[model samples]
Target: MVVAVVAAGGPGPLINGFGVDTSCLGYDAHNVAQGDADNTSHNILHTHSNKSRQSSPGKNFPLQNNSIALEIMVNVPKERKTYCAGKCKKHAVHKVTQYKAGKASNFAQGKRRYDSKQMGFGGQTKPVFHKKAKTTRKIVLRLECKKCKTKKQLCLKRTKHFELGQKAAASGHQY
Candidate 1:
């Protein structure tokens, strides 16, 4: 068994494949020695050790489970011009609006079925999913052609917040 010991800012004792005491200068020395031993282990160990040195704190380091506040503000116009597949096959002026989900129906087929199953006292009937992965939903834009009044839906990239139009700019001179 090859036991590799890694420590910060100190000369550490390492136990190699053979059961013997080996003194390593530091991580840099180990990287250099491993690089000379084999090409594969050299590449793997050498590149892996240099990443933390390459990266610093507060420099766009991506966190897997943590939520980051991007604080991004978006500005979109209320109207847009694009090709309409309806009556206007050519480019036409279109009105842009944010799309929203409708309210859940109490009499929907799935809802009715689930309600019927849970009518009697049986604790819980269906499995309630709790493992939510995403924190944001993709924003959908509703585009309506001004000429033909034809509407189409456009999906935007996911974001925490969505804005319809640009906010009013502040005047330079105050009254």
Candidate 2:
């Protein structure tokens, strides 16, 4: 009697012999390397390696488990446009010149109209004073792109309106 073992989707029988029982062969047990066995499955053939597989040309590969995808924004230059304080325009306003009204006060007058107790002059006559004239300043606006050496004027305001280091005129150009 001839016995044959046929494999599923296989071209030929796995084993065939005359005068033999196919049931005696049983199932072929797979051997795996150390740490190759799957913890959830007892079957040796179901074990998988921990190493990641690299992609080869002309091969369809599935995404790996625990992979993260990211979206990035790219800046492209077309017709250069400018964004102003609250409006967008075809040509950006190079400079916004702000003319502030001059402040007039007598605080700067050096005239000593009154003497304090700390001055030690209880009844001395007040000394004559001279006031320094206030001066005006001109600020230039500038904007530049770090990647490209392109620059343009932005906006300008009186120096008095800004604090030290807080002045937009003296602030470095932002890309």
Best model number under lDDT: 1
TM-score of 2: 0.17
Query: What digit string (tens of lDDT, one per residue) describes model 2 on residues 13-126?
Result: 332222222233332222111223452133222223335677674345443221211111122222234553333323453332223456754454442333332266456555
Q: What would the per-residue lDDT of candidate 1 be over residues 1-175, giving only the tens digit for each residue?
A: 3344433245533434322222332244345335446533432322222223555565555652233432454456899988899998999999999988899999999999999999989799899999999878777899999999999999876668767877856669868
lDDT scores in order: 0.65, 0.35
Q: Among all windows of ten consecutive residues in candidate 2, which has the lowest summed lDDT?
A: 66-75
